[model samples]
Target chain A: MKYLLLALLPVVTQASEITTQRQEELIYLLHQDCGSCHGMTLKGGLGPALLPDILQNKPVEFLTATILFGRSGTPMPPWSFMLTESEAEWLAVYLKNPKHDEK
Target chain B: MLSLSLFAVEPRGTGDMGIVIERANGSILIIETTHNSQLYRVEGLGDLSHASAVFSRDERYAYVFGRDGGLSKIDILAGTLVKRVIQAGNSIGGAISQDGKIVAVSNYEPGGVKLFDSANLELLADVPAQYADNKQSKTVGLVDLPNQHFIYSLFEGNQIWLLDAHNPKQPVIRKFTDIGLQPYDAMVSNNGRFYIAGLFGEEGLALLDLWQLDKGVQQILPEYGKDDPKKPVYKMPHLEGWALTDDYALFPAVGHNEVLVADRHTWNLVKKIPVHGQPVFVIARPDGHQVWVNFAMPNNDTIQIIDTLNLTVIATKKPGKGVLHMEFTPRGEAVWLSVRDEDKIQIYGTEDGQLRAELPALKPSGIFFTARAHQSGL
Candidate 1:
């Protein structure tokens, strides 16, 4: 029953542990920094929404790639200089299941 | 301790007030600028995400424009909401007429400009932004011109429109269809002569002369980035916050850590000064001597002060993680900067760059003073 319950639990996972400092930076980058165009809550604005449900069909790798390289011909700018591949990977996973952290 | 003598003191009852937008909670901190302190807070201001406010000529009435198409008029003295109206689903910003009789809001949702009665927030006219065969384009880069005319750019359609609201009922509209593609932000000169539009779809910007509107749009810096490989553009720069010095204009270069200096009279590029990061606001001091510039995300921590005469980054300071906006005192003695991550607004000496005083705020972005009432192109 424990295994079954564990298997049935929603998958809210991160690729790696983000340090408290790094996590705080990412939260600010996601909430307040990215909030300028992506909406304060990551819903939608000049750019599209970054909500998990909105990006549910997309792969975590795609989200990480988008954050790293940014979409061309769009307002989304590359953050490869500011974020590492691993950190972006973590953000991708967190974004996919962002509800894990309640605002 | 910073000397209190250097601080700007509010001349008693001058009504020198401003609104600081706290985007996180959709609230604004009404501050008395002369005192450099908060007077009151108006909460639940409705989608202040990328918001702006313009003061009525009397400096008593404030027209707060929100991203969620909210138009709110608040009395600065009473710190009370005069009236709040949500005119559209999404909006960029707005402009109040020179005469201060009409208020125009620029929209992105339905793609048009709406004129309202400045007194009561009544819808005066709804001009649709239709272009390119049955398509409604998002309108942006809007500004109020003299003679009761409201001017704006059509983002998707690549055109500029001017609305004459002299009658306030039946308005005549003029369209400049060949201005440029994707004109993001525009600004009218402090003298209200030149209207320059920054383009994203192309390399250069489109220039319009309100005095020479009959000549159509003229292109300047037409080859700004055509030969060079463009860097990654983090956030599109808004020209509204750019600076215009005595004979030169300092504009943030698109997608690069550079400020493009141009000769105002000749309307030609002079030089590009490399800065810390992608420039956002390159606002000149009221004296038109030194210019202060802020950067876009990741590098937004530092602000570079540029010397207008020598054209060099004279001073650089990192106030906090995200330095959003800055507003100078009417005399340009002390400048107030909104340090977003630190949740504090720092008043720095414009000359020595000394930390004067810090006022606590809640995730602030834009800061506008009531003194804007006496200025142009706010």
Candidate 2:
């Protein structure tokens, strides 16, 4: 039973809900603006890799919190002032499974 | 049956040499205006997370400023790096003196400004930007003046500095402590006569007439943003406020999807042009007949063309997703625009708005040409 649950964990986790317009906007933000520092491919530049393969190991809750309240002492500015808690969580979940958005 | 052919020797002096920032790779893609194609790619400098370049007086040497405290002097003619220096932990941008002798860098980490010798990249003067109980603040909006002076604004300090690098031995620095509010970004006029800093803490912007520095700072557009309450500012808009054409100029209404046109002589509000999104770069065409604009993000893909005479948006085209920057040819005959996600730069004819050519690039951000060498406050 434990082995079966582990096998389904990847597909069970879903991206936070967002509107179509908001999703398009978020995807553009992730690629262009953030891509200015992070790699356009999300492979990492000044900021660390935000790719799904690297992000999978990190906790989704922690990632969502970081998106809202940016890392201090680094170049990342707090996005909560501009983005909502739900929106930040949506971005966090989407980053974990970037290819899922295409489907 | 075919005759032997040889290529033209690359000119030592500037014709159309320029650079495009490859942010993710810490390199620059070189191109000439004539070919509209890539000449070479120079890399291995340092961190270029956010980078900008300024050329020498002769337009032969290019000074590349990287965000990771790296400054490199590259020879455009030889296509090689002359010297490199790690100036700061993080830098926003830099400026070059009129005489081409001094180079100034604005830094974020351990906030301050550093002046370097244009020849050897040697440290000449160091001004630590400290204020509000000795807290070092990030510096922005650094521009060059006709004399040996360099002007920049501090974000946390809420101060604007005018440094006189004329006397290399002993530099004279002036601090304008009171400038209304938060000085975010700044730019000089086309002729290098006026230096204006955009204030984010409040509505108005602080303007300093470089011709008369002792006259002090004056406030302009005091209630620019006060009237609009619903406009949501996503990312901080770059405050290169006005695009001067003929006797008037155009300024973006920061967070709002509108642009304010004002008179150059009287400094009076002329018209407010509503755009599709929050405008970032409201640049005037060289011919002074049209203006081209791009947005911050989310709405960044749409590039709009505004008629200078009519003061209205003449045309709008969504070039691809992630349309980052647009650069006009020297005579305003063509425009080179970058679509970052597509990894391509499309050139269009200004007269017909028709796509002429497309060039491939690797995540390009800023497109700077050597022709800016002869200009001021790039």
Candidate 3:
């Protein structure tokens, strides 16, 4: 019974590690591309600053839609073709849990 | 012999010293300095060209000074240029003698001011403006003083040199030391009683009495705490625009967004009026009741009209983007402005500040007007 439990633990931990790595990759992408005009640290420059408090609780679908179709009358252009649906969803999830640094 | 050289461009056919306006399209418009005459369009060679100074006693001949030291002599009537003179230096600014005999060019480099014969393009004399103690003596301002002498502002050394131009072969230097920091630009008033020195990176304009150099004339500066060295004395931030009338001297502060008006007699700050962004050049109208300021910016270009009597901005006109330098015809009917970023020369009616016409694509940087009568041909 103990050997069986040990085998199951390794499989579980490996799956969780992969999922965390994917999330981190999405966060890095959002910071690099979206952060340019929106503010490097996602604060804001030519575009409105994106705060964690304001965006963290936002709906995933709403965030994804806004990224695909940029705000009008502003410099933000539509990035629908640049990011896949999955990639956009990943960013939405990352925005929700923006406090990765928080213990 | 007065001659007319009309280059296919339109000539309003009014004044003598034609105003040169470099347009946004990299073309130049040459209009009469005194009257609204035919506008001559000339081809230019540069990303953005400005006619810094224009020299011509008669309308038949006009010499234009550019930022990169590209000088061209244009025939007003024919509307075609006669010759192109390219010297080795960057000309910050320059002035021509009253007789149109000598042209003094100021260099931003350590190389001193160069005096050239206007007609033949001969180097009459090259006065070395380098400082012996320091290697960085950049000459910034050049103006014609009384007695055929030229006053040059040495920026790095913070001094002024009065050069005797009586003999073009050998020039004599009269040095006025320790004026201020970065003496960038200067101007001699209509009466020639005072020389207003625009000092960059320093507080106040250095008012030098042409008659007495020993007792430094009053420095028209803003009030600053004696103990606080960092506090600006007169917050006319960047020493960009310096102009003078018979009664007052106007210094525009680029950083502080204000214009400091000083009494020409007392050399004291009479008033400080708020103005637009980065006022680069100020021109006193012949009436002296108002002064026109060209606000320098990459975008949102405009000209601020200051009511000199009240010492305040009466109005602002958005002519175009990148309005660099401006000049009024001797007759004051039209005001020609060099639009650098737009690459065009814009003409405005002096009375109402209305856009009369737009000449596109002239890389004009510096400009001047000639009032002499037009001749048939050069």
Cα RMSD to native, each candidate? 5.3, 5.8, 15.7
Cα deviation of A39, candidate 3, in Å: 32
Task: Name the top lDDT candidate.
Answer: 1
The two-chain DockQ for each candidate, comma-separated, is: 0.46, 0.16, 0.02
TM-score per model (chain B): 0.95, 0.94, 0.82
Per-residue lDDT of candidate 1, residues B1-378 (tens digit): 355753654434535678899888788998976667899898878888788888888888889998888999988776789999999877888988888988889988777999989999999989889997889887888888878887889888889898999977677899999787688888888777888888887877898899988989998887686656777776668788558887898888887778999998988999989899888888989898999999987688999999999999888898998888999988889899999888989999888889988999988889988888776666
True contacts kept of 3: 0.00
Each model's lDDT comes to: 0.83, 0.77, 0.60
Runs of candidate 3 exceeding 4 Å displacement = A1-103, B1-17, B21-27, B32-38, B44-50, B134-136, B214-218, B222-247, B298-300, B372-378
Instruction: Give the clashing pairs for model 1.
Output: B10-B34
Model 3 DockQ, alpha carbons vs. true complex: 0.02
Better of 1 and 3 by lDDT: 1
Candidate 2 on B1-378: residue-level lDDT in tens? 123332355335565878888766778888877868888888886666557889998888889998777899998776788999998877778989989999899887668899999999999988899887779888888888777888899887778898888886467889988886667788889778877787766766788887887888888777865667635444455655248888777877766788778787766777779898888778887878888988866687898999998899999998887676777887778888878778888888999999989988877767878878777777
Each candidate's interface RMSD (Å, one decimal) is: 1.8, 6.2, 18.2
| Model 3 local distance difference test score | 0.60
TM-scores of chain A, one for each prediction: 0.80, 0.79, 0.65
Runs of candidate 2 exceeding 4 Å displacement: A1-32, A35-87, A90-103, B1-12, B240-242
lDDT for A75 in candidate 1 is: 68
Tell how far residue B120 is off in model 3, in angstroms. Answer: 0.5
